[model samples]
Target chain A: MRIVVPAGGTGGARFVRGLLAALAEAGEPADVTVVGNTGDDITLWGLRVCPDLDTVTYTLAGAIDEAKGWGRPDETFTVRDELAGYGVLPTWFGLGDRDLATHLTRTSLLASGATLSEATATIAARWGLPGLGVTLLPMSDSPVETHVLVQHPDDPAGAPPRLVHFQEYWVGLRAAPRALDVVAVGAEQARPAPGVLEAVAAADVVLLPPSNPVVSIGTVLAVPGVRAALEASAAPVVGVAPLVGGAVVRGMADRLLPALGVEVDAGAVALHYGASLLDGWLVDTSDVHAVAPVEQAGIACRAVPLLMTDVPATARIAAEALRLAEAVRA
Target chain B: MRIVVPAGGTGGARFVRGLLAALAEAGEPADVTVVGNTGDDITLWGLRVCPDLDTVTYTLAGAIDEAKGWGRPDETFTVRDELAGYGVLPTWFGLGDRDLATHLTRTSLLASGATLSEATATIAARWGLPGLGVTLLPMSDSPVETHVLVQHPDDPAGAPPRLVHFQEYWVGLRAAPRALDVVAVGAEQARPAPGVLEAVAAADVVLLPPSNPVVSIGTVLAVPGVRAALEASAAPVVGVAPLVGGAVVRGMADRLLPALGVEVDAGAVALHYGASLLDGWLVDTSDVHAVAPVEQAGIACRAVPLLMTDVPATARIAAEALRLAEAVRA
Candidate 1:
C-alpha cells in the first residue's frame, strides 16, 4: 500500500515513526511519502534551517534524538555556544553541532542556486531516506515563513497586535504569549515542490499525522494547489486528531486552535479540516464522545489511543487510522 | 610614539606580541597600527576567513593558542569534523569551533554589505585591540588572493606552471611542491584599505616583521599605493630578516626564496626589498657576514639574535630593531 503523510516537527514526526513501524510490522513492502512542513524554516547564523523537514528526515533515518523527537542524536552545542559568545542573537533557538552540518550543506547548495527541494533531496539521501523506502518531500521549494500575531502587553487596549516570526513565538518566547493569529507568509506565492502533488495523487491513503492543525499542516494547506490536490486525490483522506483529550499530546495546539475560533477538541479539529477533505478522523478513546459529533459533520470518525508514548502503542494508533480509512473507502 | 608594522600571520603576529611587550618594558605608550596581508585570506565553507588579521588581533588580545600561535586556545573542531562527515571538502584546513564564530560573524557582516576593513575593525574591537593602543588594518578592502605557480609532476617537459591558490599550495599540498612564482591576484586593481597608507605615512617608524618575503610582505607591497607611501614617509623603514643563520626559524622561507631567484640569505632578502625601500635591516648574529653586503647595498644592517624563542627573547629582538631604526633615522 502507498501512504502519503503530511507532517510537522515533533508530534507529527513521532506519529510518522509509528506509521513507519506499523508498515514494517505488516511484513510487506510499503511506499511511504512524507511531505514535511517548511513554514517553521528560518535562517540562523547565516544558515538556512528547515526545522520541520530535518526533524522528519532525521526521525525516519533513525538519527533523531528519540527523546526530543527533533535534532540529531548525540548532538553538541559547541558552535551554538560559540555563536552566543560572539553575541549573535536569538540564542533561544539552538542549532547543535550535528544539526549545523545539515544547515551548512543546505545553505551552501541554496547559495549555489539549487532549489530547496534539490537541497533537501541531497540531504535526505545522505541519511539514506530513499533506502528506507520512505520519500520525504518539502511542502514547497520557495520560502514560506510562519508569523504569529500576539497581543503586546504594553500596548493600549485598542492598539494593533504585534507580529513575530513563528520561531520567535515558539522558541524565543517559549510559546508563553497568546497567539491571536498565525499567518504563513508567502504561502500563496509558493508552489508544491516537485513530486508532492503526484505523491498524494498516487497514494492509496493520504494521512495527516497528529501535527499542529493551525501552523504546521494548516500552513502547508495554505500553499496554493495543495488543498485542491488532496481534495481531488482518489485516495481516502484520513486525519489523526492532534488533540487527544481536549489538549495537544505535544506542542501548543490548545493555544493556537482557540485563535482560529476552533474549540480545543478532537471534534472541532476534524470540522476545521471539514468533511469534504477528511473522509476519516481518528480521536483518542478518552474523547469517544467526539466520534458522534465528528460523524454528524459528514465525516467518518473513530476513537483510539492517540498518545505516541512508545513505538508499539503509536504504531497501533497508526494502524487504527489506516483501518478507519479502509472502512471509509468508496 | 606612532609605529606601523606590515605583517603576515604567524611570525608577524609573534613579532607584534614582542613589539607590544618591548614598548611596555620601555614605559612607552605607542600607537601601533598593523597592516595585515590579505592575500592569504580565503573563503572556506562559504565564509570569508581573514587568517592574518585574526592572528594579529588574537595575539594582541592574548587569546591565541600559544602552542599553535594561531586560532583560539582550547578550541574544538566539532563543526569541522561534522562538515567532513557530510563530505565537505578541504578537510585539510581545520576551523575550530570557537574560530568558526569569527568566520560566521565576518561572513554575516560581509553579506550585509560591510567591507573587509569594517569587519576587521569590529573583530579587533571585540579583542580590545583599540584600548591596547593597537589598530589592525587589512592591506586592501578588496580581495587580493595569493596564487602560487608550481610545476606539474605529470608533465615531463617543462610546461608553463599550473597556478593554485596560496592556501592550496601551503595547506592542501603542504607546500611540498616548489613555488615557481607567487602572484597576488587583483593586487594592481586593489586600493589599500582605509587608513592603511595613512598609518604608514604618519608613522614615527615603519617595521617589517619576520614574515614571508614573497607571499606575505610581497603581496602587501604589490598594492599600488603602499610601496609609494612607505618610501615617501619621513620615518625610517627597517625590516627584520625572516631567516636565521642560513635557514628560517620556522616556515618554508628557504625553499621559496630560491624560487624567486634570490639567495636564501639575510643580505639577499634585504636587497630583494632594495635599499630605497628598506633604510635598515636586522639579521641574526650567525648571519653577521650579511651585514657588509646589506650595508654595501646602501642600507644600514644590524646583526642580532633573531630567534623568537620566547616572549622576552622576541621583545629584545624588537628593541634591537628599534635601535637600528634610530641609527637610520637621519
Candidate 2:
C-alpha cells in the first residue's frame, strides 16, 4: 500500500511512527510518504529552522527527545546560553546543542543555493532512516512563515499588526493570544515541495492524522497545486478528526479553530474539510453522535476510538482508515 | 595619562588586564585605548568570527576561559558540535555557546555593512566596560583573514595552492607543518578602524604586548596610515617580546616567526620592529644577555622577566615598559 501522510508537528510525527511500526509488524510492508508542513519554519539566529521536518526526522531515526517530543535527547543548549549572554531576546524555544548541527547544515545549504528538499535528503541519509518506508517531503520549498495575527481588544484592525511566527505563538506564547487570524504569510508564492503533488496523486490512500487542521492540513493545501492534486487524485482522501469531545486532544487547536469560524467539534471539522474534498471523516467514538451530522453534510463518516495511546492502537486506527478507504472505492 | 595598546591575542589581553588592575591600584587614572588585531578572523558554520577582538573583550569582562585563556569560562559548544554533526569539516576552533551570539551579531552587522570598528564599540557598550576607563578598538575596519601557506616538499605552488586559514594551521594542525609563509590575505586593502589613528596619535605611551608579531602587528601595520600616525606621535613606542628564554610563551608562535623570516628571539623581533618604529623594546631577563644586540640595532632595549603570571606582575611589566619609553623619549 502507498499511503501519503501529511504531518505537521510532534503529534503527527508520533502518530506516523506508530503507523509505520504497526504496519511492518502486521506482515504487510507498506510505503508511507510524509508530506511535512514547513509553515512554521523560521529564520532564527541566522539559521533556517524547520520544526516539523526535524521532528519527523528525529522521531524516525529514534533520536528524538521522547520527553519533549522534539529535538534530540540529552541535547545541550550551550549555544543558546552563549547567545543569551549577548542579551538576545526570545529565551524560550530550546535550540539544544545536538539539534544545532541540523539547523547549521540546513542554513548553510540554503545560503549556498540548495533547496530544503535537497538538504533534507542529505540529512536523512546520515540518520539512515528506513527510506521513511517512504519519502518525507516538505509542503513547500519556498520561504513560508506562519504568522498569528491577534487583534488586541484595545486596538482593533490589528494592534500595530502584532505578527508572531507560528512557533513563537504556538510554543513561546503557549498559544495565549486571542488570535484574529492565522496567516501562512508566504504561501501564495510557495510551490509544492518537489514530489509532494506526485506523491499525493499516486497514492492509494491519502491520510490526515490528528494534526492541527489550520496549520498542518491547511498549510499543505495552501501550496499552489497540492489541494488540486488531492481533488484530482483517484485515491481515497480520509481525515482523522483532530477534535475529540469538542476539544483538541493536544496543542492550541481549541484556540485556533474558532478563527476559521469553525466550532471545536467533530461535525464542524468534517464540514470545514468539506465532503467534496474529504471522502471519509473519522470521528472519535465519544463524538459518535456527530457521525450522522457529518454524513448529512454529504461525506462518509465513521465513528472510531481515535485516542492513540500506543503503537498497536495507532495501527488499528491506520487499519480502520485503510479499510474505510477500500470500502469507499468498492 | 591616555594609554594606547596595540595587542593581538590571549597573551596580549592578559597583559592588558594586569596593566589595568595595576594602574587602578597605583591610583593612576588613565584612559586606556586598545587597538586589537583582526587578522585571525575566519568564517565558521557561516558566521564570521573575530577571535582576537572577542579575546580582549571576554578577558577584560572577566568571563574568559582561564585554563584555555580563550573563549568563555563556562563555554558550551552547542553550535560547534551541531555543526560537526552536519559534517562541517575542520571544526578545530572552539566557538563557545556564548561566543556564537557575538559572532551571530557581528556577522549580521557586517553583512548589513557596519564596519568591524562600529560593531566592536557596540559589543563593548553591552559589557558595561567603559567605566573601567578603557576603550577597545579593532585595528582595521575591513575583513582581513590570515592565511598560512605551507610548502610540503612533496607538494608545491603549482599544485593548486596549499592554503589554510590561520586558525586551522595554528590550532587544528598545531602548526605541525614546516614553516613556509604567513600572509595577512586582506592586508593590502584594509583601512584603519575608526579612531585608531587618532588614539595612536594622541597617546602618552604605547605598548605592543606579546602577540604574534607577524599576523597581529603586521595586520595592524597593514591598515593604511596607522603606522604613519604612530610614527608621528610624540609618545614613546615600546614593544614587549612574545619570546621568553628563546621560546614563544604560548601557542604556535615559535613555528610561525621563522615563516616571516624572523628568528624566534627578543633581539631579532626588536630589530624586525626597527629602530625608527619603536623607541624601546622589553625583553625577558633570560634574554637580558641579548639586549646589547637589540640596542646595537639602534632601538633602546630593556630586559625584564616578561612572563605575565599574575595581575601584579603584568602591571609591573607594563609600568617598566612605560618608564623605559619615557626615559628614551627624554
Top model by DockQ, which number? Answer: 1
**Clash number for candidate 2:** 4
Query: Fnat for model 2?
Result: 0.65
lDDT of 1 by residue, A164-273 (tens): 88998888887888888888999989999999999988999999988999999998899899999999998999999998778887888898888899999999999999
Counting clashing residue pairs in each candidate, in order, gives: 0, 4
CAPRI docking class of candidate 1: medium
Evaluate residue B181 in candidate 2 and report its C-alpha lDDT on the 0 to 100 scale.
Answer: 84
The most accurate candidate by TM-score is 1
Residues B1-330 of candidate 2 have per-residue lDDT tens digits of 888998888988998898888788779985889999989988887988888888899888887888888887776776676667667434787677777778877776777677788778878777756878889999887888888887543566566447788888877777888768887888888888888988988899888888888888777877778888888899989999998999988876788889888898888988888887888999999998779988888788988989988878988998888789888989
- Name the 10 consecutive residues with the lowest summed lDDT in model 2 chain A: A150-159
- Model 1 has a DockQ score of 0.63
lDDT of each: 0.89, 0.82
Q: Candidate 2 chain B — worst ten consecutive residues by lDDT sum?
A: B152-161
